[model samples]
Target: MSTQFGAASTTDDVLAGVDLKGRRVLVTGASAGLGVETCRALAAHGADVVGAVRNLAKGEAATAAVRAAAEASGGSFALIELDLASLASVRAATDALVASGTPFDLVIANAGVMAAPFGRTVDGFETQFGTNHLGHFVFVNRIAGLIREGGRLVNLSSAGHRFSDVDLVDPNYDTTPYDPWQAYGRSKTANVLFALEFDRRHAPRGVRATAVHPGGILETELARHLGEGEVEALVTSLDERNAAAGLPKFQLKTIPQGAATSVWAGVVASADDVGGHYCEDCHVAEVHEGESMDGVRAYALDPEKAKALWARSEELVGETF
Candidate 1:
């Protein structure tokens, strides 16, 4: 794919001139933030979009723009109830989708919690890990067959994955102490590994999967758990770290800019270039061994680790793909 797009590219910039009239897409967390922007852009380009939300009322109220865009562009938009924090909800949603027998051109696991306080999901797993990783694991795998042969899966991972690798043995924090950021990190890393393994399993059928890190954006609902002044302090710390590494100060992206990479990988970029990889800023990220915000970590893409994670996820979810 020859292109000129980067960190600053908005969803519209990445999708300019592209028509998705016959495409069908599923975007989770569609009620707010990046998910809302992602759905709006895809619908505006003529894709039939299904926005999955934990709360239908909130989703309907939040997606007025998406619905209007779809109507104006000859595309379509609808909503589905999904709460990634609950296995029952995931099962019900996936079963209903599979029963509909409608195939999707792409499935973007764009819903997730970030740096949330310590808590357990409905199934008693750590909040971030359960909602961000395990929920998508079962949700996607169960509906894997509904993805057309050439379809793709885009898991929304994060640069925060560098905080720590998944602790499979202590995933629930039973034996290990709970730290919100570390838990979030584990879940984010699981997101990347899940995409990697899913790609390995499905690529032979022409279905591909990739993970993307939407650059930091402060205005999203994702920061709701942070206390007053925490965002400012976090930004200061990040900038100091970047400056010490001789890099420019960290800059938060707009929602459109933040969601750009998802559409780029899901629609614009070639499968061969992004399949089984971690992407950021509309391109495949390099594997960086150290702590930095610019690239993916080696451990996050380890094939063996990905496989291991897949197995453990199956065990925890009590479901096999």
Candidate 2:
């Protein structure tokens, strides 16, 4: 009840009493890092998992790895190709799932890019915003029917959302200058807002949605764009933000620790009860102000902004759910 599961807790630690037998789970970007661990943990607990990835080869390898890790639990793993950057791919993946008619208990939107140079996705939106937010948006809405009653949408956001809010006016940087971190922040903010609105619309049907900041830097492909000195610079900036917020210095987490909150949100019945909240370190995070570098900002949780984002997303994707 305290949600005090610290940065040291792993998916296994948080999921101790939670039984996932026969549950159907999906994880995006599941080939490595937190995604792999999330699948392993779920599968280890007897949940059937399908890891959606961009590459079939990598996905197969990841599935094997997770399967091997999960042998002790008598669980299973499967794979499907899903490139969030391409709506065509997302549609195909959803079609495959719909064909299989596997009702999902949870869908984790875990794949994302970070701090890359200015560019646009194939759909012409900013790379980070397009892939991280819009891609997940379309995929989730399309599969809304495939989600069983009381299912959960776990959008993996970031505490870096403290850096900025969604820029509805210039989301694609058509009229404004682009800053990488700011763009990433906007996407993360959108992730939370998306979950907020998603809960509003889907709750009546018993499906709930929530966003999570997995907490701290872990070794993942998401950071592939970072340069030599960027890691230290990012940490220095994070420390400064923590100092400004009167918080303790942020500590880096292990891969298992990084996946804890996500796993908690997905399978913990109590967490689903707190739908639409932003969680971190396996607890509902506090909303803070000004350079906190931790917690969800009030703006990210605003219902109005969430609705506005929903509208904008519909326009961008040229489709409405």
Top TM-score prediction, candidate number: 1
- Candidate 1 lDDT, tens digit per residue, 20-136? 999999999999999999999999999999999999999999999999999999999999999999999999999999999999999999999998988999999999999999999
lDDT of 2 by residue, 196-247 (tens): 9999999999989999998776488878898988888888877887787788
Displacement of residue 300 (Cα, Å) in model 1 is 0.2
Question: What are the per-model C-alpha RMSD values against the true structure?
Answer: 0.7, 1.4
Error of 1 at 117 (Å): 0.9
Q: What is the lDDT of residue 151 in candidate 1?
A: 96
TM agreement with the true structure for every prediction: 0.99, 0.96
Model 2, backbone clash pairs (residues 3+ apart or across chains), number: 0
